[model samples]
Target: MFNNIFLLMRQELALSVLVFLLLFIKIGKERSNTSILNFVNIALFVNLIIGICFVGKGELFSGMFATNALIILEKNILNLAVLIISMQSFAWLKNHDQVIEFYLLIFTSLLGMFFLISSGNLLIFYLGLEMSTIPLAAAANFDLSKRKSSEAAMKLILSSAFSSGILLMGISFLYGTSGTLTFSILTAHISNNPLQLFAFILLVSGFAFKIAAVPFHLWTADVYEGAPIAVTSFLSVVSKAAVLFTFVSVLYKVFQPIASTWYLILILLAVVTILIGNLFAIRQDNFKRFLAFSSIAQVGFILIGISGSSVAGSASLIYFILIYVFSNLAAFGVVSLVSALTGKENISDYKGFYKTNPLLSWVLTIALFSLAGVPPTAGFFGKLFLMMAGAAKGNYGLITFAALNMVISFYYYLRVVKAIFMEENEAPIEKLGIPLVSKMAMYICVAGILITGLASMIYDYIYSLSFGL
Candidate 1:
């Protein structure tokens, strides 16, 4: 039993140890934040490498937790994301007083995400969800001197509590009807009855809130704008990736019985989410808020893939997320560096930025190009596969609509690019000193975006996992 637990939960176990190591370091001596950050980054990189090299598969705790090739890949994707984030946060962390607390919160949320991904039952899923969310709420308040930071934390807490209630109510309804919480059993028991559908809607609402889908996305912009850049990056990349991964499992596996019903629901939500997210994003002068809405639009694209209800759909979703991690983080890396150096976060502040900061300008341009789904970038391939997977359902109209929305997305994404290169500013941001670690992180993200797009084999490997499943 012990061996099974260790084998099945190696990722979670290792992360817990890393968290403890950080705790011990915090208590032992008063080290410089730079040293602590260096230590943490090394540990995180080690963790990512270990996860990739030592993948495991099985179930434990009477099937309450499970792990497979796909889940392992999902977890490793997150590991890489956290490592990149830790690297990118170097400038911010080295100057902050609460470096250990920041990392502790990050790893705790990551540990919860590990459990959340492995959960085999509703109870375990909800437990993991709360564990992941609470830490992030605290992290949002890390900028203690800012009133907006406190407001961000408060809104997060209240919204989380509300979403948790809705989710739990859905779980109760599901259990009441199905008499089981285990995913495998729930799959067989899911029926398209009124109460069951209602429960499913409530559950999806909770998920929508997490992913920042339209109408449920009110808290996202405020939180992203108010939280420090590090937290915002974590929220945009790591947090969304975890929820979307689990959501794929729940909808495609556990609720497979009511596919048609949920497919319609997903379609409706995806269209609205894309339209609203894009429209609002265009109006945002605040860079963080702009990215917030952009992320919401990205979620809509993810839904189009999920709606396909096939192995292709699952593969596309994961592949796109991998591309998304690189693309989004690359953008955020530039944002973090610029914001940390200049205390600037507005779109107007970036006008003529390329004159002084050409490297960062190009990096952000590439990242935004990828986000806009432009060709030759990995994001283009990601969205291509997504739309192709969605097309498998023979809904050409919906596919065309999605494609058109992609054009809408392109306009706003390029707006920033244009500001950087084309617009003139008398007082542009100065040529700032870019940290070595942050530059390294940016290079990795740029490589990921380029390599993933060019390498078809990566997507093939992911598809093989989905097919095997």
Candidate 2:
């Protein structure tokens, strides 16, 4: 038990210590904020390396903490999120006054995510979720100058609290039905009870709010528009991915016998999320809000895989998320660069942006095309695998609708590309030089999008490792 607790505490301790060290270093030197940001990146990278070395398929703390191949994939994806987020945050923080606290909050949130993904019990999972969320709400309000930022924080807090209430109630119901909160034991106990079915619905609803699935996504646009772009990117990628990982684990491990219930629920949610996301994105003028809707639509694609309820489904979902992290980060990274340079976040502000920053324009073009699921990019292949997973389970209607949704999504994604490359501007925008770290992050994301698409071996390895009941 001591050994398990020690291992569980090690990674988090490293992160906390690094954050404090950076804080002290910042206080002593009065150097450029970039220096502290660099330290944060180094800390996160080191943590990633340590996680790779120490974390593997095993149980800890009497099975309350666990790790496996799937969790390793999750950790790597999150590490990539941290790297991208840190780079983007640095771009914004360079000129901002209150920068150190931003890094501290980000590290705290990521620490919570790490725990969330590795949690073996519902109690730990909820605690981790709240820890991750509360700091993020604070980060949303970090930009004290903007009223929208405060509004976003308040909305997020209110919505999060509501979701927590629903989740707690559901957990109580689940406990009453199964008499245990441990996933392994719950799996054995949750056979065919109607109350268990209701509990599953409530649990999924809570996750739906976290992932910004349709019918529960009212707060996404406001929060994205109000928060800093870096915080928005972190919320979109890392936070959403953590919730989905937990959702997949619970569906496959504890609720496998109730596939029929979740399948219908997931399919309906997918259809609504895809159509509504595309339709709403069509009218959005704010760049962050546009991507918010886009992220929701992407979640719909992920749900198609989950609806299938197979090891293939889990593998497909993970692959899609990995691809999405790259493509979405690339998009947001470019947006962060452009927004920082122009101090503009509106779509119209990007008019004739190509004239000044052709490289960024092209990067945004590629990112948008990938989001639209254009061929030869990672997003295309991610959707392809999801469709295949759905078909494997004989979900013909769901796959067909997903294909149609992809077509609808293309329209809005291409609109952003057109705005970047085709639209002319009356006012000439100044070209801003890309920072080395930011440029490297963008190039890595673009390369990852392409490489993951072309690499069949990686897909095969992931498919083989998925949990099979």
Candidate 3:
């Protein structure tokens, strides 16, 4: 047992050491921070390579640290998200102080997420959750001059505390009912006990907060509005993906026997989240807040995939997340570029943007259309798979509601496109030159959105990969 723990600890520790080394190099230097950013990016890429090489399916540390193909894929997705986020950060971090510490926090937060996707026990999961979350709150306030940033930090902390408290209570209840905290043991122990049901509700509530499900999503818009665009993109993509991955694992492995109870609850939550998120997003003029609400609606669609609780469901969820990472990153990248150039985040500020920056404007248009489930984009296929997964289980109502929500979502998504192309400008807008690395990252995302749909070979590949899990 000690040897197993040592091995697992060593693997994670190596990544930690790399992160610190980058931090040291960053702070030890003087003057411009561009080199440090470049170094961090290289380090992240190397760490991802190491993670890929170390992909052995096993449980370690008495099942507290588990690694398998599914977890490895999830971690790789997270690494991709981090790389894209770091690229986005370049524009935001120019001339910013404490740049070294910022990169350190980002790496640390990512490490936490890696642990979280592989966590095998409740305690380990909670530890990873907090480790990932606390630094992000600080990151939200990285720009100390802005009062809105500070408010975002406060709201994040408060909401995280509330969710963590509820999670602890849920863990206590589960321990009391099953007399164990290990997931494998819990699967064997869970019965139709009322205590187990209560524990499930509590656990789901904690996940609900993390995923920004309706009624628990009041903080999402404000935080997205207040945080830097890079940070907001991280929250929407990496953080939410971790939570959903863990949620699906728990539901399928630990609580499978109680599907009837949880399924109804999920169905209700999915309906409300889809409806409310779409409705609220329509009124948002702030681009960041609009994306925030759009993310919420996307979560609802993913929930429909999850409700099926099959291997196909899990595959669909993963595929949806992959598509979303590209589409949303593309949207945010364009928004970040616009905001960096014009110092405006409002939708109205984009009037005649196409005339100024046709390349970026078209990128934004494709991203939004994909998000609205228009065909020939990854988003369309993602939604198609999700609806197919739900419908496979004879969930006609879920499919119907999801379809309706997609229609509602189309209006707001197109509104942005209209603002960019159709609306008249009062003044001549200057086109800004984007950094080479940032431009490459955005183009990569755009290509991903376009190609992922055309590649129908992935369906068979996903089926085979998820067969074991």
Candidate 4:
């Protein structure tokens, strides 16, 4: 019983303690804010280690919550994400006056995500979801100097509220019909009735908004453009990935009975998301907006994996998300560095970037290749696994369409690559003196992306997780 309790709340407990300690350091007689951040980082690193070591899979809280390979995987992923967010964004935060408040909000949001990932019931999930989102709106408005930031905050809050309402409506329908909110019980209760079908659609559609999928993705570009780069990266990677993880879990675990039906719906959504994201990405001059659309397209591929609704599919989906975190963060790291140094974000501004800042240019190049699914990067293997998983489900048409779209994606990704490597600007970006922490973050991302691609152990472990279940 003690072991189960330890395993269950270890991550959250560690983080909550760290947050409190950090707050103490901030509000204490010592006016040393840097100490708070440094201590927080060290504490979080320790907490991540605790999560990895305490990994056990079972139910707690009378089965309202559960833990398993998926739960462990997601917690570790979130920990890694939070760590990177802290390290990479720390330099930027130090320059701003609100660093302490910012870190507090980030940790708060991360704590919420921990609960969301562990939730086994709709009630718990909704509680965690709302908890995670409310802080993020404040983070979006952290840049109070910009009107767009406040505008973005409003949009995010409104959209999140709307999505939550839709999700609750779906849950209400499920409860009305099935008389249970627990996913394990729901599988036995759910039937292919028209009301249940509509409920499931509401649920998936609500999550689609969270992940910024097509037809529900209207607010994404504005939010991405207006939020601080750190916040943008957080939203793009952590928030979207967590939502994807939970959404896939609920559907595959509870709604397995309607796999055939949702499969087609997912395929259709995937096609439109890919087409719209890739097509619009080509025309974007703002790098952040470019990433926004590019992310939408990437989510489409993720949908392909989810559509499989099998162990292989979940493995691939999880693997893809891991690499994606590294890839997208690398891109954002470069963009943040360049924007800080030169105030240039347009693709054209990248011309001759390689001449002055080869490291940033190369990092962005590698990230773009990975994003475009080029060979020898983790992104390539990520896409390959997702495709194979989809194909296993007889989703050849959807997979083929995705492949064609990949080719289309390469054109736009390479356009930026060409500007950096091939084109020349009379005034190129100046040389940069990267801080130690930011450089460490970049090296970690680059090494992880390369090693995960080259190493078979990574995929083998993922497949083991899939097969074990």
Per-prediction count of colliding residue pairs? 0, 0, 0, 0
Candidate 4 — worst ten consecutive residues by lDDT sum? 28-37
Could you give candidate 4's per-residue lDDT for residues 1-469 as a string of tens digits? 9877776788888888877876886677755546656776787789889888866778888887787876887889988977877777766766677777887887888888888888998899999899889999999999998998999999999999999999999999999999988888889988899999999999988999999999899999999999888899999999988888888787787887888888888988988999999999999999999999999999999988777777878888889999999999999988887776666778888899899889888899999999999999999999999998888888687888999999999999999999999997998877988878788889989987898888998888877776212
Better of 1 and 3 by lDDT: 1
Tens-digit lDDT track for model 2 on 248-333?
Answer: 88888878877777778988999999889988998999999999999999998899888777788889988889889999999999
Task: Put down candidate 1 lDDT per residue, 1-469, tens digits, no spaces.
Answer: 7777777777888899999998998899799888888899999988887788866778887889989999999999999999999999999888999999999999999999999999999989999999999999999999999999999999998998999999999999999999999999888888889999999999999999999888899999999999999999999899999999999889888888888898899999999999999999999999999999999999999999989988999999999999999999999999999999999999999999999999999999999999999989999999999999889889999999999999999999999999999999999999999989999999999999999999999999999998312
TM-scores, all models, native as reference: 0.99, 0.96, 0.96, 0.97
How does model 1 fare in lDDT? 0.93
lDDT of all the models against the reference?
A: 0.93, 0.85, 0.85, 0.87
What is the TM-score of candidate 2?
A: 0.96
* Model 1 misplacement above 4 A: 467-469
Q: Evaluate residue 421 in candidate 2 and report its C-alpha lDDT on the 0 to 100 scale.
A: 80
Clashes in candidate 1: how many? Answer: 0
Q: Give residue 44's error in model 4 in angstroms.
A: 2.3
Error of 4 at 373 (Å): 0.9
Tell me the lDDT of candidate 4: 0.87
lDDT of 3 by residue, 47-144 (tens): 67766665557787678989777777778888888888788767777667777778777778878987888899988999999999999999888878
Error of 4 at 245 (Å): 1.0
- lDDT of residue 237 for candidate 4: 94
Identify the candidate with maximal TM-score: 1
